[model samples]
Target: MKRIFILGAIFTLALNWSCGNKKTTEPPVVKPPVVSKPPEAFAGFLTVLTNDASRKIEIYDPTIENWNAAEAKKWSWAPTTALGFVTADINTFGGGTDFKLRKVPVWNNAEYAALTDNGFAAIIEYPSGKRKWSKRLSGNLHSAELLPNGNIAIAASDGGWVRLYASSQGPDQEYYAEYPLISAHAVLWDPKTNVLWVTGQHAITKAHIITALAVGGTDAVPELTEIDSWRTTIPSAWGHEVSAYYGNDNLLWVTSNGGEYVYNKTTKTFSPAPTAGLTFVKGIANQPSGQIVLTRPDYNKNPRPAMNCGLNDWSTSTVDFYSANGQLDGSRVVNGACFYKVKLLNSSYQ
Candidate 1:
């Protein structure tokens, strides 16, 4: 009887301990609160004035949201358009004379020489304030890319041709070779194949063509004659121009007054895309990370609420960005007192 009572007590105590352990181990069935992730890092744009002495090329550091303009003053000149950067002339006003000097040299027979006019190229650097190795070309250079050999390949307007150049050569040197191009505005070099991939013009009047140049010999001609050419029947009478980009899935993303068009390179044609809130699309830039930046006039016209209107209203001069798939990302209004061109720095900020 005593053994039976002891065994019963032990079993009851073990059951009680097991029940207590289960209760403590199992957490309450409460749900966790939801959290929404912040949006992606937005691209940035700035209004640049040709006359504004303070205007400069800025480098933005995303980590600290800080902008460093140390390289601005060192630049010989900068392009005036929003189509990225272009080579420009560097001129020194009132040559080599201090304003406080006794023999002050006044403006005389000094002429503005073509510091570096190898066609439409951008000044990448001007280390010693001299035009050395200032890229030279045969055709009208619309865009340039610096190569690993300290040379540059410029996309010329003459045909889909790209001219190569070395920094040690002069403007009169014959380092340029003709590569097939058709109305291309921007040319990017592919180091992998030593070839060039060009971005053609946007407008119908301008040829809608993109070409790829194969790399090999210095005297070698363009390997691929033509990659693709697209034509649209959309009426382009109102000074409407077309801009295109090679987007994801081998799709060509084009923009015009008629709206956005996506052209499948495989099918060799174009189809309209959704551009509901977009307007006055002048320039389009497709980033490698599937984001796009476009320049357009501000749509907030006069008599609209939330916008202060005045004679000095410069809101029309602005640029906005959208996602790679065509979503309204964000926008920034240029802060110049006067209306002018706006350009995006090659950096991202909040």
Candidate 2:
């Protein structure tokens, strides 16, 4: 009986010790949720300008989505309507503020000249922002191109002529040449062929001349002699607006009023582009990423003719991005009417 009582006491003591010293398990740890940021509206910088008299050279950085007005380094001093960037100061010719319709540039390469719709024309220097020379042509300045041999070919709408600034003396030396036409609108310098393509209110002319020419083998070189010319002559060409550019690989793209078409040089044929509702294209640019940027003025609210200069007042600027195949990639709108031309520059260029 004594042994049995001692055994029971030992068993109870062991049971109590095991129950009191039971091991406890801790809970698992958790982390808080993470947040992400959205992408930018655009990848690089863009220059936006207006057609009206009250206009500013607005610079927009689409990456951060902000307008950078203070960073603008202009090549010309007058109220600018067209832009051309060069490495040297440009020359200018004085004229009154007699304004008219502005011409859209074919490419935004480093240009040696800038034209103001107020009849002011000037050559600008890049890296220095100096005015080397300027000349007030006979009519309202639409567009101008700096030749390879240090000459300038200007398209003046008032006189319906393309003027050639011939210079054998140097960059500063210049003489003027006038070629009659219905209306000279766009002057483009294609680096690939070293040919200047000039578009007018009704026709597109192919100008060929690497060196300035003499009038009779003794006079100054005309620089640009018309080699070939063709007319789009579409229904829209009746004067609303017309813009053209060598899109890529021997294909020429033309848009007027609101109609767009592609002319294939290989087959010498034309086909309608997929430009459905995009009316009144202001400019066209081919980006390095194989995307084409087009400036579309809001035609619904934009009027064809306004007071004063009687130039069309473009509504809010609408820019569209399209693939090489004419597929609409995306689009965005900017506030303000009288929007003129839109240009894209690599962020690195800034």
Candidate 3:
């Protein structure tokens, strides 16, 4: 007919150009699926353990309140030379600021460790934060604890030393079994019973570790055995400085300057927290949000200080944050900043 209609219109234009150049494997480029950024439950950096402040162990940021010093540089202390403060996830360090508060300087890490009232101890060695070991004991060595097995427990508020190191100690060493408490000053570590609760100056000891520490050579010298001990009914003249906590029913709160009480270790009884009116206490903690935190001694509060837990006027208070039924939610007025104790370290990983 017209060359068979021009060969059927060139076979329908070569069958529509071979189905548009036939590369039909086009359903395999589906990529809008990459969403990993969610690990921060709690831990926003708050471990400013000072005691006789020259800035001993600091890394603060209670959500920052514009405490002006260039905004306190995101949260002070990328510096060290401590003589106090420890506790909060085995003594917290690292991750204080991407905001110029910088990071990594917990003595340069090795799962880093810290203690300094001049008697030193900075164990380390995790994903290689390196110092893997060190100890100098004898100076004021105020506090430390990390022994659910990976040994290292010191407390030397001036030679009442209750030492025990064996995470393979050997760098600047001096800890390999040393516990016979005569007067410790707070060194608590009882994750329910890997025991060790020293606090003497009237007495309170309950150690336990008859040999258990060694995961890499040089394994010996780990023996602390003081099943249980207690004596502080306080008022031994009030120059007291205490700290004790393992609460929630079996209770056992103990803090002093004679205030902060509650000890019912199954009724060996002495209770008083119907809402303590804070006058002076030195350090007691417990808060996975159930709150009950203390650290008192408010910078001569006649006027030039701050912290007023609603001031029923207990002399102006230093650090209180109650509410395990005892009300009072917040307060922090460290005017003489030697704030000696705090470790709210579940910082949501900042």
Cα error, candidate 3, residue 91 (Å): 15
Compute the lDDT of residue 270 as modeled in candidate 3. 52
**TM-score on alpha carbons, each prediction:** 0.46, 0.59, 0.28
Winner on TM-score between 1 and 2 is 2
- lDDT tens digits by residue: candidate 3, 300-349: 13242443333221122255455566665555444434554554433111
**lDDT of candidate 2 over 1-350, digit per residue (tens):** 00011123222321221100121122111111121223235553343343343343233444333232333323223323343323221233222121111122322444433434435555554423344456544565655555554455566555666776654334355566666655455555544445555545433332211111122121255644654433334323312222233236565554443344555545545566544333344455556555556654333222422212222323334455666566666654443334455444321110
* Per-prediction backbone clash count: 13, 24, 12
lDDT agreement of model 3 with the native: 0.39
Candidate 1: where is the Cα deviation over 4 Å? Answer: 1-88, 91-132, 136-141, 156-162, 166-174, 179-182, 191-194, 199-207, 219-282, 286-290, 297-316, 337-350
Full-model lDDT for every candidate: 0.33, 0.40, 0.39
Put the candidates in TM-score order, highest first.
2, 1, 3
Steric clash count of candidate 1: 13
Task: Report the Cα RMSD per candidate.
Answer: 24.3, 27.6, 25.9
Tens digits of per-residue lDDT for model 1, 14-64 = 221110001112211211112222334454323222212232322222222
